[model samples]
Structure formats: structure tokens, C-alpha cells
Target: MSLIYVLDILGTFAFAISGALVASDKKFDLFGVLIIAFVTAVGGGMLRDVLINAHPINWIGDLNYLFVIFTAVVFTFLFKSKIAHLSKTMFLFDTVGISVFTLLGLEKGLSYDLHPIIALIMGMISAVFGGVLRDVLTNKIPLIFQKEIYASACLAGGITYLILNHFHIPENIIFIISASIIIIIRVIAVKFELELPKIKDDLFTKK
Candidate 1:
């Protein structure tokens, strides 16, 4: 199997765990947890595929993808209590979730002969849309709207990938560098409580 495929699976697994954690936190039952995990794992990729006209989509034909989601959901649910420790050490599952997906989405776009700008948008969408969907379903403010440098990290990763690609970097190396960039940015943002500036509603308030 190619590294990209592995990264894609990892992204799906991480995202599934993230979703399962959220659902579990919300007191969702097993079925609801599984549903959230599956959708959060595949939703962004599905959107990206549709936009890029990737016929049949990625998970539609692959039973393994479902298997991965199922495994992730089960494991995450079983180990929910212990996962807090994991997050304390490595980047949070949500952060890892976005990092890998951003690279895969950008690569997929490049494979489709898309422009770099569009590819960057695809990367951001692929990284964050699933989380947004999950948050919306759970009645929480989505991370992107909360101004914590979520989607911006994805964008930065995509830009990094494009720059490396422009310099004729190898694919595997490019993936590592770009993915690391996103993860580091997310880690620092969360660690330092960094957030992008929000526009004031007063700007549009009627006098």
C-alpha cells in the first residue's frame, strides 16, 4: 500500500475517534456514537470527492473504510476514559485528524490537475468540514467559527505543500513536512490559547 493510502486511513481513524469522543461526551448511546464516528470520518472526504468529481467517492466502494471507522468507534468508546492521557502527550485527536486529511486532500487535488489555490481550499475543507458537521449536529460552535486557528492551519499546511512541490520536493518528504506544519500550528495554537482576530458585530450595527 502507498503511504498516501495509509495516511488517508490514519486520518479517517483519528477523525472517527474524535467524533466518537464528542458523541460519548454528549451522552450518546452506542448507535449514535457509531453514526457520529462514521460521518465525521467520511463527511469531509465525501464533500471533497464530490467537488472534485471523484466518481464513486472514496468510501462508497471500500468496505475497509467502514471497518476502520467501526474499529475506531469501538476502540474509542471502550477507551474513552483513558484517552485523556493520550491527548495530554501528543496532539489532540482532532488536531491529528485535520493534519493528515489536509495533506491527502491537497495531494488529491493536485492529482486532479487543479490549481494550487483551489487545492488549498480543498485541503482546508477536507480537514475541517467533518468537524464542523459534527459540531453542528451536537449543537456546539464549530472550531472554524471559534477562531482557534483550525482551518487556517490546514491552509498553511496546503501552502507549505505547494511551496515544497514547487521546489521539486519528493512526495513523501513533502507530506511529512506539510503535515508536521499543520500539527505544530494546531498544537501551539491550543497550547498558547492563540486565536485569529474576530470581526466585530458593531461594524455592521445600525446607528
Candidate 2:
């Protein structure tokens, strides 16, 4: 299989695991856990496809995606205690998922003849919207809306991909470098508690 396809599956798996863990923490039952896992694994890609008018969606046609998500849920259930004990387990899986999803979605948009800028937006959406949906469903704030460097990392990675592609970089190398940029940026941002500046305190005050 192609490296891109493998990365896509891996991202899906990671997202599914993360979702399952969150659902478990929320005391969701089996059905709720499965639903959350499914949404977290494919919600972003589905939104991206619909925005681009891609027919059939992705997981709808590809049973492999479903299989990967199912496997992830099972794995999460089997190792719930052990995985939960690791302080950075969710962070690690989430970082991997977003990094891979950003590049894959960006490349998909480019293949559809989208402008590079629009494709970068698509990349950001694909990387973060799944988590957005998950957080919304779980009654928590979405990370993208928070001050943390979430979608920005995806945008940075997408820009890196575009710049490398402009120079005719090898596809495999570009994928690795671009995804690594997203992962590294996310890691550094979280490690140092870096966040975007908040809105002015008086912006919403009475005139």
C-alpha cells in the first residue's frame, strides 16, 4: 500500500483510540463509545469531502476505515487502564492523528485542483474538526478554539508541504517532513505551554 494510505489508516486508528478513551472517561456506554469513536475518526474527513463535493464520502466507501476504527476501539477497551495511566497517551495519539490528517487532507484538496491557500484551510479543518466534534459532543471546549497552538500547527505543516512541492521535492520526503513539522510544532507548543494571545479584555465591554 502507498505511504499516504498507510498514514491515513494510522491517523484514523489513533483518532479512534483517543475518542474511545474520552468516551470512556465520560462514562459513555458501548453504543456511545462506538459513536464517539466513529465521529472522532472520520468527522473531519467527512466535512472536508462534503466541502469539496466529493461523492460517497471516504469511510462510506472504504470498509478498511471502519475496520481500523473498530480495531482501535477494541484496543482501547483492552488496554484502557494501562493506556489511561500514561500521562501523555492521549496527547501522543492526538498529535500523530492531526499531523497525518493535515498532510493527507491538504494533498487531497490539491488533487482536486484547489488553490494552495484553500487547500491549507482544508488541511487545518481535517486535522482539528474531528476533535472539535468530539469535544462538543462531550461537553468540553474544543482545543482549536482555545489559545493553544492546534490548527496553526496544521497550517504551518501545510505551508511547509506547499513550499517543498514548489521546489519539486520528492513526494515521500515531503510527506515525512511536513507531517514531522506538524508533530514537532505541537509537541513544542504543549511542552512549553505556548498559546496564542487572547482577545483584548475590553473588546466586549460596554462602550
Q: Residue 124 CA error for candidate 2 (Å)?
A: 1.0
Model 2 Cα displacement at 32 (Å)?
A: 0.6
Candidate number with greatest TM-score: 2
Which pairs, if any, clash in model 1? none
lDDT of each: 0.84, 0.87
Q: Report the Cα lDDT for residue 110, model 1.
A: 87
The digit string of per-residue lDDT tens for model 1 on 1-207 reads: 286677677778888888898899899999999988888888888899999999788789688889999998888867878887887532554566688888888888889999989988888878888888889888898867977888888888889999999999888898888888998998888789898886766677877
In the order shown, what is each candidate's alpha-carbon RMSD?
A: 2.8, 2.7
Q: If scored against the real structure, what TM-score would every candidate get?
A: 0.88, 0.90
Tens digit of per-residue lDDT, candidate 2, span 150-173: 878888899999999999989889
Per-candidate clashes, comma-separated: 0, 0
Model 1, position 68, has a per-residue lDDT of 94
